[model samples]
Target: MFISISIPLADETRVRPYTIASSPEDGDLFEIVFNRVPGGAGVAWLFERKAGDEINFTGPFGAFTLERAPERELVFIAEGTAIAPIRPMLRRVFEQKPGHPVRLLYAADRVEHLLFRGEIEGHAIAHPQFQFETIIADGGQEALYARIMAEVERRWVVTDNDRMRHFYVCGIGAGVLRIRDLLRGAGYERRAVRYEQW
Candidate 1:
């Protein structure tokens, strides 16, 4: 879900949408992640703030959350900080359906840029039905898409229960659209895919 963060400035306030990164299981401690981009006022203000500093924000709005999709397999594709929403969703999935098969295809240009990689990999190790893979988008031309398609074929498309699957894609807008297009072009119904892009 998305939240509107309010930054109290000298003259006025600045508001920006942030997807809560912390799991609802994290309780009162909500976390939001961002890279401080140059000339980004909200990002700058957020980074400069210290603990206990007051800020205002509203809404857990977005239609990216889970839905009633029968007993479907779940696949999450995320890039960079787009992993924010996926974390909480994954946690919820594990909490609600530990034995359900879940796969994550995480893309980043560099290994260091992939957030919580080790932590999630650890989850994969512990959860028998959980699997995770990393894709470096810039490594080669169309390499990321190729890898994602390969994963879909190997993990989802080939499965006997392929029709009973839900795909969640989160990343930059273009990437999300491209993946959705690829999946649709490959014959997966549009309703089976859900996305949140920035």
Candidate 2:
């Protein structure tokens, strides 16, 4: 789910949607992850907030969530800050559906841009059912998608009866669309792939 925070600028109020990175099990405390975009008012406003400052938001919005398909293997593809939502989903899967096999293919422009890297790696080490891979796409989104597609082709064998796999992809609009289309072209059904694009 996401929260819409309104930032009051000198001219107008700008609303930005941020996915909650913390798990529901975390109780009263929650977290969000974002990178500061140059000249972006929403992130600028958020970055300027100090302790004791109060910010108003409305949410628990968006239907982009994990499907109740414990029998299916889960594959998550996330780029950049899109990993925010996937973090909680990973927690849910590991906690509630430990038997389900999961693979996370995460990409970032640089190694430093890979969020939660150590934590995700730890998950891989701890859970045999979980696998993680990271791609450094210095050549931008196209490079990221290309590397992801190559990995998918090499690692997964899509077949007519491959109904036991579910894909969750999140990224910028173009990259998300490209990956979704690639999956579809590889003979996966529309319902088998769930995506959130911004």
Candidate with top lDDT is: 2
Model 1 lDDT per residue over 1-198, tens place: 889988877777888788988876678878888866668776888899898888787898888886332366778888878898898787778767544678888987678889988879888877888889888767643566566667666665565445656789987646578778766766777888888878
- For each candidate in the order shown, give its overall lDDT on alpha carbons: 0.77, 0.84
User: What are the runs in model 2 whose C-alpha is more than 4 Å off?
Assistant: 67-69, 157-163
In TM-score terms, candidate 1 sits at 0.81
RMSD per prediction, one decimal?
Answer: 3.4, 2.1
Scanning candidate 2 in windows of ten residues, the lowest lDDT window is 155-164
